[model samples]
Target: MSADETPQGYSIFRDTMADMTFPEIARAAERRAVVLWGLGVIEQHGPHLPLGTDVYMPSELLRRVRRLLAERGIDSVIMPPFYWGVNQVSGAFPGTFVVRPEIVIELIVDLIKSLKKDSFARLFCISGHGDALHNRTVHAGIARGADEAAIAAYFVGAPSFFARVGIAADDPHILPTHSEVERPSRYFDVHAGKFETSSMWAAYPGLVRDELLPALRSTDFGVEDISEWRKGGDHARAKTPQGYLGDPAASDREFGETMMAQHAELVAAAIAAQVGAAR
Candidate 1:
């Protein structure tokens, strides 16, 4: 299904916790339905894409994943999109809102506590941002939340994040790596490049500045450049002057759609496995 088309009988107001009344949410919790949360960051994705790119992508993925879950007879509820995420790498950008890692951790822990209080036993966090520190912080938050609240919670994100944070590849909470779903431009599509630009084009076309795409050039960011970019602030800006890493001009809606679909499938499968194991 296209981004513009909603599945028949699918209602956001009915599926999301934010839109439901206290009694409805209590009933969902009693049913032991998994709670889904999209973890996003308000960061710059070049001039062509909106600052909410991270939020929109994960929220869209969660929507698709929720449908897939329902098709499998698994019930789930979505929380409102959480966009106040750590943005260390893109802090130099004008629109990026960088928060302390501890703040994210505390907020997540509190969220889990509140859910646990409501009798919710499971939670799944899906993030669109790929910054190493951000992912690590989120993982830490989930870990802490599970321990403190005695709830089963998982963080789903890029497989590389596990290795970056010293988690084993086989870690149950981390989504297993799927080579089949890997992007063709994974090497260079680090930031608001062809990969993300194409994604926004497919998922939120109106938010993308299509006219600016033609003039945007691609930057061949090498390992050394990435090392500098990781420093963030001035160092990152020096490496990516225009605030993007890859070729935005090469973006294609079809590519974005395929990528999103494949990723949603992987996420749904992972969530299903985790839910079963928890049960």
Candidate 2:
């Protein structure tokens, strides 16, 4: 093989993972290893961001994390990303798809079980969906399904990162003066709305609908706290005609890079810890 094509880098995004023979993978297990599986919702991301915002963010971060870990001689692979998720908030917006909470959990369990069957001893789930309670419950289910086949199945994104980034503990936008916020809005939009818009713009520029940005509305009217925000239903505060909560106009690529870099670092560190513990 050519030098460039060699598995010199540890990233699964590279051809190396695809080209890896079963024997190759088994041999590599003698060192240290981990595999990352991603789950993202294909739902509304306000007026400017694409419906695939949630999916794209985790996938992109997994790619970057794979590269980062490779730099440290860590072995990692990013499996195909799951687009199914509990999308309650963006359901009011067109193109949003909601998978029932039970289905999401069951699917995750099956995914983890299969990974364990394949001898992947360490697994992590990365989600960018609306239902916090549901996602955590689902993660627990996946861990249960893994049983003794693996060590643990973890959910990477947590409230701590938002806290660390200085995002206040208020719901970004869930309730408007006229409507009751639903389950989807309460959990997902904590950092949804403009924050998600800016993030998508940073990760995948072409997915953003720039023309819609000007028309998007930025309002604090619907939000009471972070918990009351609606995840679904035809609420008055569900979305502005433009579909964003805060001002996506203020979003820049730099901020997106910063957010993504931090997430990658967290993933890499977690993988390192999990792999070490497995040994």
Candidate 3:
């Protein structure tokens, strides 16, 4: 194998308790081992993206981030994906498995406590789906973590970074509103648009049908909060019947691969920074 393709001696699992030894685990934990958890929604992602699109995208980041951390002697692992995330808007879609918001929060809280009990140095949760309530819940759980564990917890994804790096700033469109302050006008979706389609195409070719781009591409857009979406997935279905909000035709694998690589880079850097800061 080429040097770049070599495997670093790090354990990446859906669950970490089963495969690690006590002494080995202790060595890693002492070195500030960071657990990278991939959180995603089992929801609908238009025609071109797969139903597990949210989880898969962030999992890709976790996978690559493990390799980066391994190279630096910072023990790290990617746990099995936590797919039951908050997908209130996608409830209208057939594939969506919407769970109560509290369910996700509780799951996160329990997992954090479990990891903290295990003596892990830090835990970073990366979610592909952007649910404000979900993010807030995760943050709250992190805040409640004990001082000794001092868990470094937060959410990371492409959309948040896109805005951070001036990509969103260029297009003054506020999603539901082009530009203006409005109540519950807090969310916007390019749905199966560029990011979702491209990332899926890059990671899982079997799961994506690039030929369906014509059917998936559309200019339909909408805005709604978690409460409205909780009413039912039908509302979202009515907003964008195709289950997408942006053009999938322009989603090329090359662009998708490049975007995913950059995303992985950004996420890995963030984890590294958090680990360093925690120390």
Which structure among the candidates has the greatest TM-score? Answer: 1
Q: Between candidates 1 and 2, name the one with more favorable TM-score.
A: 1
Q: TM-score for each prediction?
A: 0.91, 0.74, 0.74
Ranking of candidates on TM-score, top first: 1, 3, 2
Q: Residues 1-279, candidate 3: write the lDDT tens digits.
A: 211123532222333434667787677677767777777788887766778777767766677778877776667855677787666667767888877767766677777777777777566666677555455544454445423346555554445433532333232211111222111212343467765677777766667877788655445344454234434457656667777766677677777777666666666666666556556
- Comparison by lDDT, 2 against 3, better one: 3
Model 2 C-alpha lDDT per residue in residues 1-279, reported as the tens digit of each score: 211234453222343345567777676544436777667777666656667677777777787788888887777777777887776655666787877877776777787777666677666666666455445555556556666445455555445533433333343210011111121322233444556665666766666777766655446544353334453465524444445555665566667666677667866776666556556
Clashing pairs in 3: 14-80, 91-233, 92-233, 92-234
The local distance difference test score of each candidate is 0.82, 0.59, 0.61
lDDT for 224 in candidate 1 is 78
Candidate 1: worst-modelled 10 consecutive residues by lDDT: 6-15
Model 3 steric clash total? 4
Backbone clashes in model 1? 0
What's model 2's lDDT at 94?
77
lDDT of 1 by residue, 20-89 (tens): 8999999998888899988889999998988888888887889899999998889999987778888888
Name the top lDDT candidate. Answer: 1
